[model samples]
Target: MVSGLLWPIIKKTGPLLMLLGLAAGGYWLNRHYREILTPDIALGERLYQQGVDGGGHALQGVTQNDIAFDDAQFNCAQCHRRSGFGSSEGGNYVLPVTGTILFKPRTFERADLFNKLFKESQGQVFRARMRSAYQRPAYSDESLARAIREGVDPSGRQLSPLMPRYRLNDTDMAALIAYLHQLSIRNDPGVDEQTVYLATVVGPNVDSADKTAMLATMREFVEWLNLETQGNLDHPNFSPGYRSDFAKAFRLWRHEVWELPADPRQWPTELASRYRRQPVFAFIGGMVNGDWTPIHDFCEASRIPCLFPFTDLPPTGHTNRYSMYFNQGLILEAKAMGRFLRAQKDPETRTVVNIHSGEPRSSQPAKTLTQSLHGDKRYLVVDLTFESIEQLRDQWQKLARQQSAPIQAVIWPGTFDKTIAAELPLLARYAERLLLPSPALEANQTRFPADIAGKLYFSYPYELPTAYHPHAFRVRAWMNTRDLAIENQRLQFNTYYALNLLQFGLEHVVDHFSRDYLLEYIENEAENQLNPGTFPRLSLGPGQRFASKGAYIVQLVNNDQRQIHPVGDWIIP
Candidate 1:
C-alpha cells in the first residue's frame, strides 16, 4: 500500500521509548534490592564472644580468679597466658617497666594520634606513659617501624611485655588501608577513667612521686566519682557544686574568673513555674519545680564556653554537621519505641496498657494524661505487683472477654526483673514483648536512662540528658509532661530513643577505637570463619560506595557470659 511516512517516525520513537522504560525499570529494581551496610548494623553482630564489654575486649566468660594474675609478678594473664604470666618459652622474661604501649586503635586518626602523642596535653594525665615510652632509646622512629613490621616492642622488648606488634608488611598495610578507604564512621559511646585503673596511670609513667591538687582531682574522679578523663573538653567550669565557681574547677586562662554570686540563681520555691521559661542561669537553678535546678548554673552565670552552643542544627544544615565529639544525642537512645510496639500490637481487641513501676520518667513525649493513650481505643495499664495473682487473673479474664474491638494494644515497655517478666501472664497473649536494646540497656541499671552511673549527675560540660532529648524536650514543654511518661507503665528509654550516658567518656573513645580496628580485622575474622578460598574484597554493596550497616556490638555467649566483643579487643577464636 501507499504507506504513510508515520511508520518511520513510529519505528524510531518506539525504540527510544523502550530504552527509557528499561532505564526506569532498572532504577526501580536497584532501589528495591539495594543492601547498604551501616554503622549501627555492625553493632548487632557478636564479636566479644563473652570476652568483653561492647567498648572493650576482656576475659568475661572466665572468672577473675580463673585468669591467673599475681600483682607482685606484674602478670597480665589475659594476653601473656599463665606460664608464669609472660615468663616465656623463649627463655626471655618481658619486663613491664622496660616497655610501654603505643595503642594505635583504628579510631586513632594519624593526625589526632600524632597530636595526642606529641601535643594536646598541657596537663599531666599522660606524663607517665608518654615519658616512659619516649625515654627508651630502642623506641626511636626506626625501631617503631621495625616493631610494626617485625612484631616487636621498642625496647627490643618481646611483646609479652606489650601488645604484640602486627607484622604488617609494607605492601599489606598499604593495600589493606586502601581497601579500608571506604570504611564509614559515625558517633561513638561514652567511656571514663575506670578503663585504665589508677595503678596503670600511676605506674612507671608519672615520675612525680609527689602528688598535686590536679592529681587529687584525678584520683577522686577515678576512685569515687567514677569519672573518665576525657582530656581537656571539661575544663574547670563544670557541674554540681563547682558549676557556680569557675575558680573552683578551672584556673582562668583568658581573664579573671567571673566570680558569680552564690544566691543569684536560688529560685523562690513557690514561684517555681514562673522561672520555668527563664533560665535562672545556665548552671544554677533551685528545686523550683519538679525538675531539679539546672546543673549548668555556674557555667551559665559566667557564660563559660560550652559544647554545641546553639539550639538547632546549623542553618547551613549541620555543615559543621560533623562532630567527633560525643553528645548525649549521639549516645542516649529511647525514642521511636512506640512505633515498633505499635506495629507489632494485637489488633482485634483495642486495649492499651502500661506497666512501669520503678523510677518514673522525668520528662515525657507522651503529651498529657489525655494524650498518653488514645481516647477511643481501650486503655488498661497494670503492674505485676499492682494486684495479687487472683485479681490479675480476673482482670485478664475481663480483658479476654472484651468485645471484638474492645482493646487495641497493651504496651509493656519497661524491663521487669526476670522473675516478673517471666511471671507476667498477659504479655504471653501478645505477639512479642518489644525490647529495643543497645549495649547500654544491659549495663544501664535502675539509676540511668542509659548506663548505670553515667547520668547528668556526672559529666561537667554536657547538659542534662533530659534537656537534650529533642523529641521529648520539644514536645514535653507544652504539656508539663514531666514525670508523666515515666509513670506510664508502657514506655521506657532504650536504644530507639534513649541516649547512652557514657558515650563521650574516655573508655568509650578507646572502645570505639578498638572497635574500629576490630572492624578492619573482622573482614579477616569473617574470611577466616568462612575460610573462603577467594579473599573477600571490600565493595559498596548493591548500588552505592558506602553503607551504614557496619555498626553493632557483637556479644559472645559461652557459659552465659554475654560480653560485647569489639574487633580489636583481643584475638578472636
Candidate 2:
C-alpha cells in the first residue's frame, strides 16, 4: 500500500531519489497542505478568535496597565482580523502579524502598510485611515511572541496601549505562531496564468432582441480588452506601467453563456450542469423579467459573484453576499410612491388605487406598493383583466365617475399601450391623480394626450433623458462604429455600463480574480466614477445591493411637447 501511494507521488513530482534528495520536496508538501501540518494550527486559530485554550478554557490577556480582559473583552481577530492583516478603528492602527509580513526582511511605514490593508478590505466603509508616524521592523519568532506577551516590539519599543498582552504558555504561543505562519497563504480558484473565465446567465423568457444586445455588449468589450492587451496575452510578464502591476501576464477573458429556463425550479439544475462543465470566475450583465431570487440563491450558495444584471426586483435586506443589482426596479418605484403618499397633507382622506393587468410582472409592483402602504388607510388594489381597450376605458370611466372621495393617486404599474393612452382623455376627471412608472410612460409617450402630460407624475429611477443625452449620444456613436443597431436602448445602455464597471473594477483588482475581491474592488472604486451611463449616480457600500439608491419624481414641464422635469429633490426610499 505504501509503495502504491509513493509510486504515484514519485511519478508526479519526480523520481524517488530526487524526492528524497531535494530540499524542494519539503517545500512542495508544505505548499500543498500547509494548513494540515498540525491540529495546533486549527486550535490556535480558534483560540485567537474566541480566546479558547487547548483545554477548552477562555484565554485571558492583560493590558500594559495591568487591567485584565476576558475572551469577550479581548479577541485577537478584533484588532488583527482573520488573515492576521490587522485593522484600523478611529485613529488606532493595528499591526500585521501574518507570517509574510512578520518574517520578511524589510520594514514598512505605518501609512504604507495601512494603505495595503485598506485595499485588501476592498474599500469597505467605516474602517478608519492610518495617521500615525510609527514604523515596524521585521520580526523573528521570539520577538513576535514577546510583542504578544510583553507588549514590546521587535525594536524594543513598547506597543500601543490598545494592544493587550496575552498570558500564553510556550505551547500555546508556538501554536499561535504556527497558525499565523499559514494565514492568507492559499490561492483561491477561478484564476490561472493563462486565462480568467467569466459567465453571464440569460433567462429563457428574456426577449430575443434584449438578449442579443446584452450578449453583444459583453462580447465586444471582452474582444476589445483582449486586443488592447494582446502584447502580454501569453507572455510571462505583463508590460510595465499597466493599470495593475499585480498581473504579471495578460490573462485572456473567456466568456460562457448560461441560458436558464423560464421555470425557476429548473434553474438550479441548469446552473449546476453549466458550472460542472467549467466553473466561471463571475457572472455579469444577465437579463431577466421576473423574480431573480433563484439566481441570487445560486450565487450565494456557490459563493460566486453575480453583478449588475438587468432586472428590477432583486433580493432585499442586507443578508445577500454575492449578488448586486442596478436598482430595485418596480420595488424602488413602489417605495418612492409610498414616500410621496406619506408626504401628502390629507392622504388618509383620499383613496389610493393600484391598477394592474393581473400579470405577475405587472401586479408585483402593485402588491409591493400595497404592502408598503399597508398601515395607511384608504388604499385599494384593482386588478384589470380586460381583453379589449374599450372595456378598460369603460371600467376606468366608471371608476372615475363612481369616486365619492378624491383619488389622491391612480397608479398604473404596468406598461401602457396606445389604446390605453388614447382613452386617457375620457378619464380626465382624475387626470391630476395619475401616477405611472417611468417605463409605462416611456412606452406610451407618443400616444399620451397633451392634456395629460402636465397632470402625470412619473417615478424616474435614472437621470432625466435630457441629462442622459450626452451618454446616449456617446453610446450611439460607439454602437454605430460597431455596426450594431441602437435596438433596445435601455438594455444596451445598462449592458454597456455593466461592462465598463466590470473593466474598471478588473483593472483595480489587477490579477486577483477571487470573486469576493472583485466585488470589493467595485464597492470601493466604482461609486463616484461610474459614468458614461444613464443613471444620475451609482454607488455601493458594505451591505448595499442597489447601485442607484434614489429616484426622481418628475412631471412634464410643458416647455416642449415631451419635456419632463423633477418636481422636487431626489428621494431615497
Against the hidden reference, what TM-scores do the models get?
0.24, 0.72
Weakest lDDT window of 10 consecutive positions for candidate 2? 122-131
The model with the greatest TM-score is 2
Report the error of model 1 at residue 127, Å.
Answer: 34
| Prediction 2 TM-score vs. true | 0.72
Worst 10 residues of 1 by lDDT: 281-290
The Cα local distance difference test for each model comes to: 0.27, 0.70
Model 2 per-residue lDDT tens digits across residues 98-188:
6666777545443334334554443333233343345667788899899889889877888777789888888788888878777655434
lDDT of 1 by residue, 313-391 (tens): 1111121211111122211221222332233345544444333323222112122222333443434433222233355
Q: Which candidate number would show the highest lDDT if scored against the true structure?
A: 2
